[model samples]
Target: DMNDIPPVFTTVPRPITLDDDVPIGTTVINLVAQDSDGTSPNNQ
Candidate 1:
């Protein structure tokens, strides 16, 4: 939910999936990320 820092981390497919046994079409996941620099990597 942020665009102010370097993308040091990433998530595959933009979205992931749960319900390993049965995917009933109502599955969900969390696309997460974190920056090496919390405030600003560019020192802005």
Candidate 2:
């Protein structure tokens, strides 16, 4: 998985309220990221 990610990405803390209660087996990642490619990733 590390090889699939870029090295120039930066991320900061950004928390969001749960849209809905997740199931027991669910996995979630809540983060705000900024990439050198000029795209912004939100609440991932």
Best lDDT among the predictions, by candidate number: 1
Residues 8-39, candidate 2: write the lDDT tens digits. Answer: 43566557566576777665664555434333
Candidate 2 — worst ten consecutive residues by lDDT sum?
Answer: 35-44
Candidate achieving the largest TM-score: 2
Q: Candidate 1 — what's its lDDT?
A: 0.54
Clashing pairs in 1: none
Structure candidate 2, residue pairs in collision: none
Give the local distance difference test score of model 2.
0.47
Tens digit per residue, CA lDDT, model 1, 1-44: 34466655467646555556775765476565656544543432
